[model samples]
Target chain A: MEIPDKSATAPDFAEPPVFAEPWHAELFAMTVHLHKQGLFSWLDWTAQLSEALAAAGKHHTLDGGDDYYAVWLDTLLQIMIAQGVTDDSSVQAMQEQWRNAYVRTPHGKPVRLADDGAD
Target chain B: MPHEHDDHNAHSLLPSEPALRVRALETILTRKGLVSAETLDEIIDVYAHKIGPHIGAKIVARAWIDSDFKQALLTNAESILGEMKLAGRQGEHVQVVENTANIHNMVVCTLCSCYPWPLLGIPPSWYKSDAYRKRAVREPRAVLAEFGITPSQTQSVRVWDSTAEMRYLVLPMMPVAAAGCDEATLARWVTRDCMVGTGIPKAPQI
Candidate 1:
């Protein structure tokens, strides 16, 4: 991703789509909710989200949802670790599961762990 | 019955390339410690259960009952909304477009999916699709038609494009059946599509 340096404004990225993917809402709400809980202040969230935006742009991976949320999820996880709220391994494991689920699911099914037998 | 084991699916453990890349960055960030799964789940649950388009319904109902509120909504929506304790969040600027006999409004973020999140909890998945973004602006009538709304040809079609600074909500024409209804009951008639200008509110059956 294009991690913009300090003093660099974000590129003219498209405004977030209004009706976006479920994952985007999940990431967006989680970010908002965490900020509300004082996990990180708005300033911290902005900087992190901005960095994610730039990075996603750099990698040609920013989409309306997937990459966008993925970047956001990474930023939140990173900030939490920086603040000692959480660690890398925990989020890493979770992300791995989500990623795996997303990859293996059919084109139109919910992402889930392969070992998860229940619907 | 044979023991049901998740048989070999070699690719099952692997994520999409983009997903892997994100996981890798996450790994790098917290190489030392971990964030709790509970935190993430708590946040997700709140959004899943608590938020939706109901807030927008309240605003629409208020506008219906009070002309002054409607005037305030059209002229100074941000402050008025703030007075109702809804200041724009995430750098949002909001405006409301009223549907009239001669004009029908629709909203699209041609550049992206900018929306009034404070009013409507989250934009639906369909709103963010490239198809809706590209086609809604160019062929709003056709798009609306697909949604089963065919505004008369004489009614002007106004398409509002959202930006990071500004977003829109459509104030649909209140139906005659709702004339004597209470605000909460009337609010029920205001669907999300009404605010997007693709649908009209239907009054309750007496």
Candidate 2:
């Protein structure tokens, strides 16, 4: 089959490279850190991710953006909970703590759980 | 894009849901002494700056100028990369497929984004796009066309599906115009897309 010349077409390549947001990188690093800490094996991690992707696939097409990373985060949480590393309540509590910290944090100041009187 | 609103203020006082979740997870992990913040920051820094397409470019450039290295790369990329201290994490197993006059190779992770991150860093957003993952295999020519890459009729397109077990990198053919160029000069011509097979290395400008 003769492929037509389509060199003139220009697709935008100016989009954010690698991580679009700080949290994406943070979430990714945390997963890797846990794996390195023997919390879960890489094989286990990939399996969980694959399962998450399959589950997500049932809803809609994954854009591999926030939706994809959301699945990634879910996989991390699932593995962590399954491994007895942490549970839903603790994660929720920490999330609430962070929410409060960030809300009260002044602009350009670092948000920390310590600042919010939560350890 | 779901993150369009957050884009307006990267440092917004109101953190997004994902941001909060990440922070929560980090705190939980840190409190238990399971992980450290410094290590997390180091890992992120490595991916953001230390590792990327430029590393792959150097490998590709060396292969272009050195026949022995090229042969070694195609046969056992993982070991060659390991010898260079570039093999680890997502790059545990890698295969380098060469582009020739008769064959062209492209890569896609139809299941999820299983790229050789140690070499290419995090994949470009488009590589993970639903449209790309679905179409790249079903209609490679058309998808490549969208990337402005139209392989000639005589050159067959072969799409390699990347997975957690195996990853593939396309060793683009050195442009004829780049003859006699040094490795550094040759590396400059190779882009991330070239290694991914979505686009070819740019011809050197005279």
Candidate 3:
């Protein structure tokens, strides 16, 4: 909704932004976008995220599959963006890209980001 | 047909769906070395800006203005946020750290993205970087420099990596000029870098 100054650092890059509200889908959407854009190879990302979780497991002395996945998603986006593979914009751009890349038919339409029902 | 959709939704919780298309791009970029700083900025401008910090600013503003709320935030973050009806769906147990000159804080999920979603809307682009994760804990000063933050001789920085059971978010100290400022105005000062403990909140130019 708000476009920060481009010169200003992205919250994910420089500072974490605090929100008065909760937006879980938004977070999921970001990850899905990066995943769509090919910032990190899925296999590499999955392995690293799993490793991050395994490391956390040692620290907390607990099994953290979901937490590991969440961290993986977070880290995947972070590193990929850092590496310049694809960013928040590219992730967001996936919608338009997919729309343009895929053709729609009368029976079914190509997947749009909002259509993560398939996800 | 509808049942098939439901079945997909059921399996969504499992990590089976490979997040196909994005991964392909990552492969290409990896081959091309396209994940540079400038390209990342452009990428976030498109996608991350869609949701992350725009939401985070409001949370920073509220924390600056409210005292009892701040104390409540410091302890039992999840329930307090739930009382405000802002607890995120997956934000299980969240914690807030106050960043001060004497002691600064940086958060990482050396393992994954275990962030305090109730307060900070989303983690930043760099927080997820392998270089950042590997270097931050071992070589924080160097990483902080990339974000333009260099601590003074007296300051000590502490980095915490969030795990599922415990997630962390930094409560950057409110600026003096920010006193009596409205939430929207105050939010402007809460830069994305500051929340991650990469930089200090900049003072207004005279």
Between prediction 2 and prediction 3, the one with superior DockQ is 2
Candidate 1's residue-wise lDDT over B1-206, tens digit each?
98755645534345455445444443333333332345645655544544456678778988999999999999989999888877676656799999999999999876445677777766665665556766898999999988899999889999998876688999999898678766767677777778888788864332
Off by over 4 Å in 3: A1-48, A52-119, B1-51, B203-206
What's model 3's TM-score?
0.52
Q: Can you write out model 3's per-residue Cα lDDT over A11-99, one digit (the tens) per residue?
A: 32343332211222233444545555665454455456657656665555432233433454556566767876567676556534444
Q: How many clashing residue pairs appear in each of the predictions shown?
A: 17, 0, 38
Candidate 1 CAPRI level: incorrect
Residue-level lDDT tens digits of model 2 in A1-119: 22222421222133365788899999988887877877777776777787778778888988888888899998888888887888999899888988877665666877677544544
Give the Cα error of residue A27 in candidate 3, in Å. Answer: 11
> Tens digit of lDDT per residue, candidate 1, span A35-95?
6666766655655666566655665634345645666667776776787766767656666
State residue A117's C-alpha deviation in candidate 1, in Å.
24
**Candidate 2 at A12: error in angstroms?**
17
What TM-score, computed on C-alpha atoms, does each candidate reach?
0.64, 0.88, 0.52
lDDT ranking from best to worst?
2, 1, 3
| TM-score of chain A, cand. 1 | 0.56
- The superposed Cα distance between candidate 2 and the true structure at residue B136, in angstroms, equals 1.7
